[model samples]
Target: MAPSKKMTFSRRSFLKSSALASGGMIIGFNLFNACKPEAKLPVDLSALNYNDFNAFIKISEEGKVTIFSPNPEIGQGVKTSMPMIIAEELDVLWEDVYVVQAPLDTKNYTRQVAGGSQSIRFGWEPLRQTGATAKQMLVNAAAARWGVDASECSAKNGVITNVKGDKLGYGDVVLEAAGLEVPEDVTLKDPKDFTIIGQGKGNVDIDKIITGKPLYGLDYKEEGMLYATVLRPPAFGQILESFDDSEARALPGVVDVITIGEKVRAYNDSGKNSWTMPMSGTDKVVVIGKTTWDAMKGKKAIKAVWKTETALESSETHDKVLLDLLEGNKFNTRRQDGNVKHAFANADKVLERVYESPFLPHNCMEPMNFFANVSPEKVRLVGPVQTPEAAAQVVADLLERDLEDVSIDMTRMGGGFGRRLYGDFVYEAAEISNAIQKPIKLVSSREDDMTMGVYRPSSKYKISASIKNGKITGYHLKEASINGNMYGLIPNFFPAGAIENYQVDTANYKSNITTGAWRAPYTNFLASAEQSFFDELAEELGIDRVQMHMNLLDNVKNNPDANIEYSPERLQGVLQLATENSNWGKTEAGVFQGLSVYYCHNTHVAEVADITMEDGVPSVKRVTCAVDCGIVVNPFGAMNQIKGGVLDGIGHAMYADFGFVDGVPKSNNFDSYQMIRMGQTPQVDVYFIESDIDPTGLGEPTLPPIGAAVANAIYAATGNRINKQPLINNLEPKEKVLG
Candidate 1:
């Protein structure tokens, strides 16, 4: 077979071409290239090797196989699990395979994003095919050398074998296979034959992480790099009026005090009707110094004045604005099923409840920081970012450099629920470096990162249902939120298609405080509110809580509505598993249980939380989770994700909330804004349904259900129906409440 035609590399493709050229035996994807699959290829190898392989799999003559992971590692274990899938299909031993994080290259790798729990869900097939292609090429090469039919040869454990028992190692035949043309298509290994995927494996960076080695963004260092810090406006809609930096400049080790102007965001009419990157950082003063401590002291010494813009929106007015809109006559209907008006009027019993959640901050453990070296000819950036492709584009535009002249390297993140998705920190570092004409590292203090936040918008929901003849006949939900509605109240969620009459209406109030995607996005709030309401309905009907959910699942199964997105059998699988594992409806004295199930990002999860009162506060004693994400790629990593998500959900529901006064955030540090401590963490047990289906996302699907489970358990423990978040103060001692 002859090699495929060579092609030139685009600016994006050239980033990874050099790495692929040195690493042998890359996969070819002419089939998916024309159709343009959502997950893209490796950097184009054609420019370096003159052969158009996708460039994901590589083998060296030293008996080593190197696989490139194409997603950002934000503590979700993609840095380990993705390579496990590829190595499984390639028939390589786990010990000999090494994983590498691919750089930002859009031409070869499509949709290099870390949010929505979509890394493995979208890359399963493409990565499997990449490995199988490499295996077939090696088998063919071995057969040709042995002068036998290709069907008589077999590959296993990185070795090629013939019918007569002759064997050749993958490293010995890798060079010969590299000369052959990549096969257009190849059969993937059956699930029963998988040796590396289903088995438990530790994170690739465990040794480095546990041994106090440098692997995160804050640990990154460059030659002749100065530390920089910026003082942003006190609040949103405020601008820099004046500053006295004489004291700051006079401090020892202080280099310069520069003023960064407010950025103007222009609407991009030439393309989609969306907002692009701003011109620069917020209106603030930048303090450049020799060390991080020096920058911190200098920043504190500087004095500045700010003036608020009266015309802009304020958080202080959002609550009243949202409350007014919820009752107003005008609303945009997102989904409507049967006649809700007629069913509500004719129902025997009507149930209505209101739920409110406050805006929350990401509070990533490492704070926000990035290192950049910008020159007139080229720009280089290294940082912890969720979307590297978007960051590269923003850096090029901000520095007035060509796309080909910019390069980005991804680092391990301390934590990024969804905070790193934006390129704000990366752009800030690059701009400061460009202005100073030197390499620099920008670090944000805990207070700085907390105040200048793009938060999870506050939201309110009014959910009502009409029950007639012991069956839910009508369902209506009205949501009002700040910024924009994250979830559009689709009909695919629970009780939407299950009921005969369903309708959803929504309204949005403008906000000056920046807002963006949070973990699990809108499902985090919607699932909690809807599930808690369902528990109330079940209590009113005198039915088992688990049985109530099971009945609704049966409804969706029997009706077969086109609006249903999840399979009824999959939902039932997790629910039944959770019920059996937690021994639902049979709890010991002093222990109350809550059950909830949800499906999102192509994954279904059911969680049961056991709660008890400890010193007048709700204490989560234990939690059991049942997840059905098709197939478990890495059992250890998947379990870790579920545990982490459940813990995060519990913390946010029980203790985390942020408030605003006038236009400034009231909670700026951990003293005011609380986080989950190790003492509060509950014991978690995870179980997975055995299946042969393709893998789905596990990072976020387990999060949404945990909140409802905890909230429902709290209601069971106490007679109060808590509709608002931060349930800390809401729960009082039973003795005090009775008095």
Candidate 2:
């Protein structure tokens, strides 16, 4: 099959074009091309015609528009929200606009990554400009035909009207517009004039998803493609030594057995450690067969020997190491303001607490899977991945092929809480295909997905505060974790500006176990610890929790810090909105409440959890949340993200637990791993702060606050200050609670 033609437009080279055989207009713009020095402006388009250009916007003779979305969709609703931004500024009817996922095009797109909840935030301005520019060109064409000044013509709902009341549809002038010179400047709609944005629009793929369409990597297949299942080391410190595959090869449908990872192992041993590279070890045994079942069975039949290069790590040992680091005096100071040592020495009162959390797996609904076909000419990769460009690069490097020879097609991901950000699975598929010189689909069972995962690091935090004469004078925080510490930007958030003598110190112990970003990353657990500590500090100071937080926010707002990364005004707004809507100080009988507020991912969120006792057990009944993520693109999709984040926060903090014993994962599947069920979900009420500011991240900001809210509420109902995660472990017995 011949590759499709793509024409990319930018502020520079806006009029550059090629001859096309059709009578329509297709427009596209490189989101980041404006900053490049290489883009030449005002290219001649007199020799060009319209025919076969396929890009962001496609206009038909019937006036229908198709906008291609360029970002990978990992259940963050970018697929729906991104195109909405274009259609809004293009002045097109929403019902007449169709959306399609654009294939990976690194040449024409930037920041295609899906993690960090930054898709909408980065695409806001560029997308609007593209749409508005196309609409302006259409209006210009209509004005020229009417022999009137372009400024005298107006466009609305894909139609252009002049001062004389002459009208022309976008489709009528699209072909002529294609030949016209691109305008250097275009007018964007004011927020108040927005008709499609901020309105509720259903997800474009909702129908396909509900009808069980093949949208995920696990559902993808190709003609003449084989299946592959890999056998990896059971423990982190172990590596593949040898494997006997004669019995496995004798199986009925088993095709072949092979070994991979020598090159990767050499790369890792070269003394330059790269966190972005695969962490699931470099040695693996692959079993290929005609079907998935045959491959899995052959893998089960193989006999493999492993060797350990380092001491096997256990959760108990990690616990001791983290606690010991906290108790010791040696640490790395992340941030410091004023004189913390003097403030602590001269304080009237001192309070301290330690909080701990276990490692967690993403446990996406669809297990890891990828399809690869490698040949001397080109490499084709299809799968669900959060970082498609990174995956393509890794595969290119692994196969020792040119980067341009590799192509990626991103399918809709079932779930990617940062786990899919790594391209280990993609590398495996490509490596196997390159070795066998055939197309193959690599599938991982649930057990494989869980045990061999880059998980959320287990961590511990010790927070201390000094109160002098009914006011907090000093604040200090110490962090200890596995592999890494909190991101450098986090120490400058919230309490940094609020306290005069504040200090933050961090320490970590390196282990063979692989750990990386999970959900909101460090903030997922850090927010819970800090918020819970603040609640206890308020109680010790004889002040109301809400008032205490408000006062602290005021301090930050009054005297801002140069290094502070959050907006005090925005944080205060969400806090006030959440408290007012949840009736913070007042609740009906049999109800107990808790509140928490946090800022991350360039967004602010506040939550209040309401709890009720059912049969002597504290049960979360509802949660109220207020979010300030700037202007919401799609209220319906935004609501879903907020609600899903809140529930996920509650579920993980309440039930999710993971551990390693003798370097092997303790839980291999959901039966062994604990998770909150459908019956345990709380009613989440979300409210958005009205604003015209550009949008920020929504997917991760709401999550950081919900766990803290639920934990505080549990304390209110049971009179127990839980300082650890998987709150079920710390909750008192039903008999003791009833007494």
Best prediction by TM-score? 2
User: Which residue pairs show backbone clashes in model 2?
Assistant: 20-49, 20-50, 20-51, 21-51, 22-51
lDDT of 1 by residue, 426-510 (tens): 8788878888889999999999888887788888888899999998899899988887655556557776667878998988877
Model 1 TM: 0.93
Instruction: Report how far off residue 128 is in candidate 2 (Å).
Output: 0.8
**Candidate 2 Cα outliers beyond 4 Å, as residue runs:** 1-10, 13-19, 34-55, 266-274, 485-489, 560-562
Candidate 2: what lDDT? 0.84
Q: Model 2 over residues 58-129: C-alpha lDDT tens digits?
A: 776577888777788888999999989989988999998998876676443457788898989988877887
Estimate the TM-score for candidate 2: 0.94
Off by over 4 Å in 1: 1-55, 262-282, 311-316, 732-739
